[model samples]
Target: MIYSFRNSGFRDPETGVYNQTYFMEVFNREWHRHIRDHQSLALLYLCPHIHETVKQPHLLEFFMKQVQEAILRTTDLVARLNNNSFALGLFNIDEQGTQIVLHRIEEKIELFNLEYGKKYTSHVDYELAGYTCTPARNLRIELIFEDVESLTHELEMEKNKHIELRQMQ
Candidate 1:
């Protein structure tokens, strides 16, 4: 049987990216597949820091477009976890490979800022938490998720401190 996404609840309405539910489902399958195939998988959590005042629907769309362009492989998947946060699943990639992809994404955002920075007065201060693992008997998805979530939260806390400092200055 073929599955259609029209009513599948697998996509985010706002960003048109895969939803968390779809990501989780795919992640489980991919995990086992990697174990069987002896491949690697990388997950990246990205938070793009768009100033609260500059919130725009089109901006998010543009960011996601940039993300798609940055992804090296057609097999990689990008999903929207929330308005400002996104998750990327990179298949057949090790830790070093994940860094290369992350760098490319950062470069794209830098170029984007060069074009829109003047008007928006806010750049993409991204917080990226990445993990790469070969599927194994001991690999626990929850632990990886917790680590990334904690890292993302730490970055947010740091960003908030800087924002407050700038406001006070």
Candidate 2:
């Protein structure tokens, strides 16, 4: 079945997953719900190394599908933020819980790499980076959204900085 919403720009045509636009929308809604209900939420940003391995377009699709299925839960939401980058919104989870969930996802990726790397005729390498946040009651959803947005941006900047430093070697 096609999983998409009305006028949803978050749906990626290649992997049939929600895109960043959908992520922000869902996150804002969930954030409001959490604020009202006093629940917790976590966000995970996943960067797959599929690009470093196979140049084949179809292989990337397969890799995305596998990663999507691996990390997603019935209560969780996943989005393709851009090429080789994905994000997850996990509701009602705290920082430690988020860490455990992310570890499981990492394990799944490793297992898939071992199982299908040779068969797919592609080298497999991947890395994951994530952050968790639980907003305070007094905080507005818009502020929380901005905080997460800035956090994500900072994380990407740090990653790029590290990459640049390594490349300078």
Candidate 3:
């Protein structure tokens, strides 16, 4: 049987991205398919750290658009999780591809800052958490949701080190 999740109340009303429920359903099937094909599966959580979201109703929309442009692939899926954070399901993507996507996201943020940095006096500070799963018997399916906290914390620490290095330079 064929099914359409778009209209099944699985979409986020604000950003039009899939909600966590829909993401879980889709990711499970995609994960198995990728494993069978011996392909890599990448998941990313994109969080904006210091945005003035309460004052800007369009903040989420802009971030969503930036991510969409960066991914630019029809196969990838974006979902809004329970914590209001966004996640991307990147099928058949590798570690290098994940880094490229992150760089692109950073470039997009920089562009936005260049345009509106002085006017708003606040630039978009993003914290990204990425996980890549290669086809393996030892691979864990629960890591996607379960490891988000630790993953993001690690990412933040890495970003802090980079910031410090740049300051020293």
Best by TM-score, which number? 1
Error in Å for residue 85 of model 1: 1.6
- Comparing 2 and 3 by lDDT, which wins? 3
lDDT of 1 by residue, 131-159 (tens): 77777767776776666777677767775
Residue 56, candidate 3: Cα error in Å is 1.4
Model 3: residues with Cα > 4 Å off, grouped in runs:
1-8, 50-54, 157-169
Candidate 2 Cα RMSD after full superposition onto the native fold (Å): 6.6
Q: Give the TM-score of candidate 1.
A: 0.83
Greater-lDDT candidate between 1 and 3: 1
lDDT of candidate 3 over 1-169, digit per residue (tens): 1245656588777777778898989998888888788888777777766444547666676767777788888989998885547888888887778778778877887787676576676777667777776645566777555565467666677756211100000
As for model 3, its CA RMSD to the true structure in angstroms is 6.3
Q: Per TM-score, what order, best first?
A: 1, 3, 2
Q: In candidate 2, what are the lDDT values of residues 82-148, reduced to their tens digit?
A: 7866777888887677776766776666777776766766555544555455555676655543444
List of clashing residue pairs for candidate 1: none
